[model samples]
Structures are given as structure tokens and as C-alpha cells.
Target chain A: MLTCKDFLSELSDYLDDSVDSEIKAKLEEHIKACPNCWVVCDTTRKTIQVYKGQTECSIPLDIHARLMAAIEKKCAERGK
Target chain B: MSAPGSEAIVSEESGDLALARTGDAQAFANLIQRYEGKIFRLAQHITQNREDAEDVLQETFLKAYTHLDQFQGNSKFYTWIVRIAVNQALMKLRKRKTDRTVSMDEGIDTGEDIVAREIATWDPSPEEQYGREELAEILDSAVQSLAPAYRTVFVLRDIEDLSTEETAAALDLSIPAVKSRLLRARLQLREKLTKFFKHKGDDAFAYM
Candidate 1:
């Protein structure tokens, strides 16, 4: 029986699916029996999801232009 | 959880990479186009400043272009550029004197009694509760509140979806250290978001 502490300690590996099946079964058993651990797991998963769902911030046009100009200048210098 | 637009880039990368290495400016520009937004977002998240992020973004691409030959193609071009961008971002962070060094061996408290306090279930779609700009602001501030050490790990591993091995290599931390920091980062971010996401009665509260 994995304690909540054990589950917490293995949380990252568990979520990443890096934990072996034996430990995974124990952690899953712990979460099933523990509401707190379940909530923590569920919420933490959601936290990653929310951040992942964010759209990439578009580069500002001026910044994009500058990057292009810099790249072109570097290309020209390398050409020379 | 590859970043959006990354799949297309990966499929097209071999050709672009070959041409870019040959100093085809257009090929390099195509590569840049594929990754600029993601790199900028990553830079902004790491440096926590627009100006710094802009500089990191430009420097990352320029450095990539200059050192194009150095990329051994062992890793995805995205991963290669990410390594450069992360370095650029961290350099910018250190330049601002806001960087904190966390020991790889430092222990994070995951004691038995350390279960999360706010266990209230969140709205089914907490993200949809806010407007796009508002959600972005909320997320930015939440992530910004994290220490740079934890924030960087989280951004790279979670948001950027870098593999654990990749993240460890990029941050120069031991695999265990990366795992420790990532765990702490995820839990802390979860706690921080709980305040905004926790379900409320009748009023149907939304994240502020």
C-alpha cells in the first residue's frame, strides 16, 4: 500500500509514465483509496494541461523584422 | 505534447536543415519562421521580461545560424534550437541578476503529511472561464511567481514538452535533480492555480 507520501514522491515519474508497472499499480491503488491524492493528481495534470493549452505568443512584427534583418546581415557577412 | 507547429517543422526539417547549413538564407528563415513564436514564448517565460525575451529570441536564431554546422543532427532541430534558446534566456536572466542557484541535491519536502491543502475540484474547463487575454495574464503571473529555477524546469518540461532526458541535459542537472524540481514545480503551480480554479457555489465563480 503506497502511502500518500510515497505517491507524492513518485508523482512525477508516475505522471510521466516512467515508473515501472509494479510501482504504478501501487500508486494507482493509493490514489484510488485516497481522495486527497486523487485530487492532487487530477489537479496537477490539469495544471500542465492548462499551460500546454496556451497559444504561443506571436512574435511582435517589429521584433520579427529585426530578427530577419539580423539574419540577412549575418548571411551577407558569411557570404563575404 | 509537442508544441503547436512543431510536427510540420519536423517533417520539413531535413531539407531545411541541409540548405540552412549551406548558408541558404531562405532555408534558415523558414526554420526561424517555424519556431520563432514558440522560442519567444519560451524566452519570455524564462526571462519574465519582454525586452529580454526579444533579445533572447534574436540571439538564439542568430547563434543558430552562425553555428549551423555545429548541430550534429542527433536531436530534433526543435530540440537543438530549444537548447540554444534556453541558454540565451538563462543568460539574459543571469545578466539581470535575478537568477538563483538551486543545489541539485537540495531536498524538496514531499513528506507524508504534505498532501495538497486546496483539494476543491476545479470547473471542468477552468481555462474557458476566462477570456484569452485574461487567461494568458493569469497564467503568466502564476508562472512568474515561481522561482526561476523551478519556473525554467516547468516551462521546458511541461509547457515546451521537452523529454526529461532532454530537459536534464539542457539544464545541466542530474536526472534525479530534474525530476525533483519538476515535481516541486508541478505541485506548486497546481496549488497556485487552485485559488483561481476552485469551484464555487451558485455564483459560478470564474478565475479572476
Candidate 2:
């Protein structure tokens, strides 16, 4: 029987789908039988999902202008 | 100006990349326009500051442009730029000399600390319950609470969608080290988020 500690150790690999079949099956069996582990697994998965869903912050206009000016200066220097 | 989320630039990236390598300023600017938003976001997440992120964004592209010939094309241009951005961000972090920075080599034990303290299941679609800006604030605060070592790994591996091998290479960590840090980061963030997302009637302080 996989203990909660054991399941915790493998949780990341399990979520990543990188665990071998035997360990994966054991993890699945453990989660099915253990609500706590299941919640941990499910919530952890959702945590990743939430972060991944975040849209990239757009560069502020002032910063964008500064970046362009810097690039233009550098290009001119290289040209010279 | 290109729209903020213009992924259409991807198909044209290779052509711009070729021209940019040959010192075409407009082509390089196009490349910057496509990736600046994402690179700025990446810098913000790692450095946890807007000023540092802006500097990193500028420095990363400037360095990339200067070293354009050194880019061997073994990786996607985005990935190559990401490496530069990450390094620039880390340099900023180090310069601040804050206590939050921990050596990535410090060994983390996956023992009792790994146990899930908040076992309550979350509301389905908990993120949907909050406004997008609120959710972003919550997520950012949660990530910022983590130590820099874990935060960097999580940002690169999870948020940036870098492959484990690529992340390991970028951070100069062995594969197992990356896996361990990522695991710790995920569980820690999960536990932190549970405080916000768990069921209403459930014991918010519930322990397994």
C-alpha cells in the first residue's frame, strides 16, 4: 500500500505523466482509496492550471519606447 | 503597433530572425515586438519588480541582438531569448542582495514538509469565481511568497512551458534537482492557493 508520504513523493511525476506504469497505477489506486491524497493531487493540478492560464503582462508604453530607442541607438552604433 | 497577443507573428519569425541576424534593424525590432510582452512578464515573475523587469527586458534583447551571430539556431529564437532574459533577471535579483534569494544548490528534503497541510478540495473552477485582475494578484502574491530557487524553477518549468531538460539546462541543474525543486514548488503553491480556493464550508484550516 502506498502511504500518503509515498504518494506525495511521486505527486509531481504523476501529474507530469512521467512515472512508469507500475508507479502510476499504484498512485492512481492510492488516490482512489485516499481522499486526502486525491485532493492534494487535484488541487495541485489546478494550481498549475491557474498559473498557466495567466496572460502575459503587456509591456508598458514608456518601457516599450525606451526599448525601441535603445535598440535604435545600438543599431546606429553598429552601423558606425 | 502589433496587438498584445499577436501569435500570428510566429509564422513570420524565421524570416525576421534571418534578417535580424544580418543586422537588419527593422527585422530585429519586429522580433522584439513579438516577444517583449512575454519577456517582460517572465522578468517580472522572476524579479518580482517592474523596474528590474523592464531593465531585464531591455538588456536581454540588446544582448541578444549584439550576439546574434553567436546564436547557433539549435533552439527556437524565443527559447534563446528566454535564456538571456532569465539570466538578466537573475542578475538583477542577485544585485539586490535580498534575503529571499537562496542558492539553488541548497538541498531540500521532501519529508514531513511535503505532506499536504490543506487537504480540502477546491471549488470547481475557483479561479472563475474571482475577477481576472484579482486572480492575477492572488497568483502573483502566492508565487512571490516562495523562495527564489523554487520560484525560478516553477516560473520556467510550469508557467513558461519549458521542457524539464531545457529548464535543467537553463538553470544548470541536474534533471533530478529540477524535478525535486519543481515538486516542492508545486506542492507549496498548491497549499498556499488552497487557502483561497477550498470549499466554503470546509475547514479552511483543515489538516490531513
Candidate with best DockQ: 2
lDDT of 1 at B155: 91
Model 2 agreement with the true structure over B1-208: per-residue lDDT tens digits: 2356545665588889899988889999999998899899889998999998989999999999999999888877888888899888888877886554555654355455777888887899987889988998999999998887888899988988888888887788889888989999999999899989988879744454
Q: List the residue pairs that clash in candidate 1.
A: none
Best by lDDT: 2
lDDT (Cα, tens digit) per residue for candidate 1, span A1-80: 77777888898888888999999889988998998899889989899889889857688899999989988898888889
CA shift of B3, model 2, Å:
19
Positional deviation of residue B103's Cα in model 2 after best superposition, in angstroms: 3.3
User: Where does candidate 1 chain B have its weakest 10-residue lDDT segment?
Assistant: B102-111
Q: TM-scores for chain A, candidates in order? A: 0.87, 0.89
| Best prediction by TM-score | 2
Which pairs in model 2 have colliding backbones? none
Candidate 2 lDDT at B25 equals 90
Query: Compared with the true structure, what per-residue lDDT tens digits does model 1 show for residues B1-208?
Result: 5669867757788899999888788888898998899899999998888898999998999899988899998887888888888888877766764355433233344434335777777889997898988988888999988767788889989888889989887778888878888888888888989989877662355443
